[model samples]
Target: MSVQTWTWILVGITFALYFGIAIWARAGSTKEFYVAGGGVSPLANGMATAADWMSAASFISMAGIISFAGYDGSVYLMGWTGGYVLLALLLAPYLRKFGKFTVPDFIGDRYYSNGARTVAVICALIVSFTYVAGQMRGVGIVFSQFLQVEIIWGVVIGMCIVLVFAFLGGMKGITYTQVAQYCVLIFAFMVPAFFISFQMTGDIIPQIGMGGTLEDGTYLLDKLDALHTQLGFKEYTTGSKSTWDVFAITLALMVGTAGLPHVIVRFFTVPKVKDARKSAGYALFLIAILYTTAPAISVFSRTNLIETVSETKYSEIPEWFKNWENTGLIAWTDKNGDGKIQYIAGSAIDGKKPVYTEARGSYGERLIANASAAKNELYVDRDIMVLANPEIAGLPNWVIALVAAGGLAAALSTAAGLLLVISTSISHDLIKKQIRPDISDKSELMWARGSIFVAILIAGYFGINPPGFVAATVALAFGLAAASFFPAIILGIFDKRMNKEGAISGMVVGILLMLFYMMKYKLDMFGGGTQDDWWFGTSPEGFGTVAMIVNVVISLVVSRLTSEPPVEVQEIVENIRIPSGAGEASAH
Candidate 1:
């Protein structure tokens, strides 16, 4: 069967299964909508959390980013996975013990201030919306390639499917559906990885295969390093980012991961505090399976890409090349009219204009080249590497189709989770808690569903008419979370004297600082600056670390100046720290 046929079949089946789960697990009450009725098992919650955490960035983009960034990409692996440890040890169980349906609920009640809750809700909306834009884009990308539909239509379709599950089933439906999504996505990701590993190194394990000796009896890393040098790129095993930047970026991502409201809200769904702890561990384990394999896949794909495309004649390039090129993800210009493609590091060549000048097929069967003169004549979108891997390696069409489904699963699962957080914060925190405390449960549920519908539409709009700001919004989202929520939540739990004044002030300052820095550098706002202008050589991505530190310090200083929290609030903190009687504590 054609790839499209297989893609439609696999994607259709997964969609049907998700819709069925939604129907079977439709939410009945506000509790079900918000926290799955607090009956989720640890293991199921863990898998669902894994699915929720791994977005399009993980599924479609991480390996590709690693493939190009090489060792610098380790920050992503370490930062993301390390945050789970923080979540498990520092926040998850305590928050679960607090027994709230959402993160804002805890923040509001802990501070005994509706203002704090409103701030938390705003942060949640910002982070969730920024993150969901990327997921929607991932959906559009996959649909554009696999289903041969326009990207806008693909996003619309994705928004509709998500609305069906998220609007109807709420957290209960999302949880069970995520369990299935985890299975499908993991299988789809690992199958091609295993096949490619064996094909490259005669080993079934991608981790070992990356380090193992190849058929030529040379170590894979050694060969990759040599190829990298030959092409004028950095060695695959080494990185070019400064040590401080790496450390800061890693720290920011770690704290940001723990701070993200969507991931934190997952802990609230479990039945017990112990389940939340166990679920965090399970989530880490499941996430590690993919995280550990990504670097290996990165090495394999980079090596495969170089070997397959380097010095190949443009006309004779692989069928996959042409296919992706038509999607505008892969492009080549025949510099020097050589009719041969050059795949080398961009830095290796200077002052050589590409021979293909026209926007149309002036390049003769290829789109106009957007890539400047480089060692290579081709520009391959980093996002397409993983999706194109199977075809590049001549894998079966079904495996390719499976990848499409997996990409959607990852994107949609995370999107659903973020959208839920957005909806819940508005409906439960802003409306029910602050605006209309007397609202009925049915009315709250209705508002939640309505919010989901509106959020999806807004997210879809961003996906279709994505602003320039949306490009780096994912990292910025992490930065915002790190600067705002991580400090507030951690201090709230660990410090009894931290009052609402301190928490709210810190979050506002932290998020604003991070946002200002990101806007200045990323969007060239505030009179336009370059990396050279960054404070202490910290790029926008790493500036969150500085902002987080400032948040902590400011929070501590402000809290010392302000009156201590009420006696009830202090007791609330002490009670959450203890595991004994946790079930009873949550019963309140």
Candidate 2:
């Protein structure tokens, strides 16, 4: 069967299964819509949490970034994975004991002010929107290649699919669906790694194969380093980023992971604090399977890409190149009229991405309007590396099709989780909790469903016009989370005197600082400046660490100067940490 045929078959089956789960597990009340009725077992919650946490950033773009950025990209791996551990051990169980349905709920009730809840809601929307944009873009990228559609239409399609599940079953539907998604995405991610590993190094374990040698006894990493030097790029194993920037990015990702509202919300689904800890453990174990495999896949892809396409004739380029080229994710220009692709380190185009012209060159390669004056002549979107890896290696069509399914599963699962957070923030925190406290569960559920519809449309638009690639965009979302939420939640739980004034002031300042920095560097807004002008040598991606520190400092200073939290509020904080009388057998 053709790859497209297999893709249709596999995607069709997965979609059907998702739809079936959504119907069977549809939420009947606001509780189920928000946290799966608080009845989920540890194993199921762990699977769902892993699926929720591992968005398109993990499945599609993380390896792609590592493949291109080489050692510098390890920050993402360390930051995100470490951030999960921080959340699991440092925050998850405590937040679960706090027994809030959403981050805004915790912030509102803990701060003893509706104002604090409002600020948290805004932060949640910002972080979740930014994160969902990446998932949407990932969805668009996968569909554009395998289903052969434009990115915009692919995004629209993804929005529709997510709407069906989110609207019908809310968190209950999303949870069960995510468990299935975890299974599909993991299987899909591993199959190609196994195939490429055995084919390249006579080893089936990608982790082992990455270190193993080729037929000529050349160590794989050594060969890649040699290839990179041959083409004037940094050696694959050498670090180019400064130590501070690396540390900054890692810290931002770690705390940002801890601060993320959607992931925090996952612990609320379990029945007890113990169950939350257990689920976090299970999720870490499941997530490790992919996290460890990614670096190996990165090595395999970087080596395969350099060997397969470097200086190759355009007319004779592999089928995968043309297939992705047709989607505009892969483009090559005949610079110097050589009719061969120059896949080197420098910028291939004047801009970050290719601006393709309707016309084709003499060699039939796509013509880009903004081709750089430099000798480089190829542009490959980093998000496509994982999806293209299977095709690049000429894996079986079934394996390739399965990857397409996995990519969508990874993307859609996270998208649903983010959308749910957005919906809950608006419907529960803003509308029901603040404006209409008297509203019944039925009306709140309606509003929640309504919000998802609007959120999906907006999310699709951002996906169609993302600020950056999948993983980069997600990193910024982490920065937002770190900047705004981490301080408030930590101080709220650990410090009894932390007041609403301090928490609100800190969130506003941190998020605004992050937005200003991101816009100035990433979008050239706020009087845009060059990379050299970054504050304290931090990249926009890593600036979250600075923002987070500022947030914490400001929060502490303001709290000391302001009136202390109410007696009841202080007691709530003290009780969550008591550890005993946690009602281990009772559901929230």
Which candidate leads in lDDT? 2
Best-fitting candidate, scored by TM-score = 2
lDDT of 1 at 571: 95
Q: What would the per-residue lDDT of candidate 1 be over residues 186-212, giving only the tens digit for each residue?
A: 999999999999998999999999999
- Candidate 2: regions farther than 4 A off: none
The digit string of per-residue lDDT tens for model 2 on 1-588 reads: 999999999999999999999999999999999999999999999999999999999999999999999999999999999999999999988888888899999999999899999999999999999999999999999989876877788888888988998899999999999999999999999999999999999999999999999999999999999999999999999998999999999999999999999999999998888899899999999999999999999999888898899988888888888888888888888777777888887888887678888887787777899988888888889999999999888899999999999999999999999999999999999999989999999999999999999999999999999999999999999999999999999999999989999999999999999999999998788898897898999999999999999999999999999998889888888888887867562356
List, in order, the clash count of every candidate structure: 1, 0
Q: Which stretches of model 1 miss by more than 4 angstroms? A: 347-364, 369-375, 464-473
Scored by lDDT, model 2 comes in at 0.93
Error of model 1, residue 586, in angstroms = 2.4
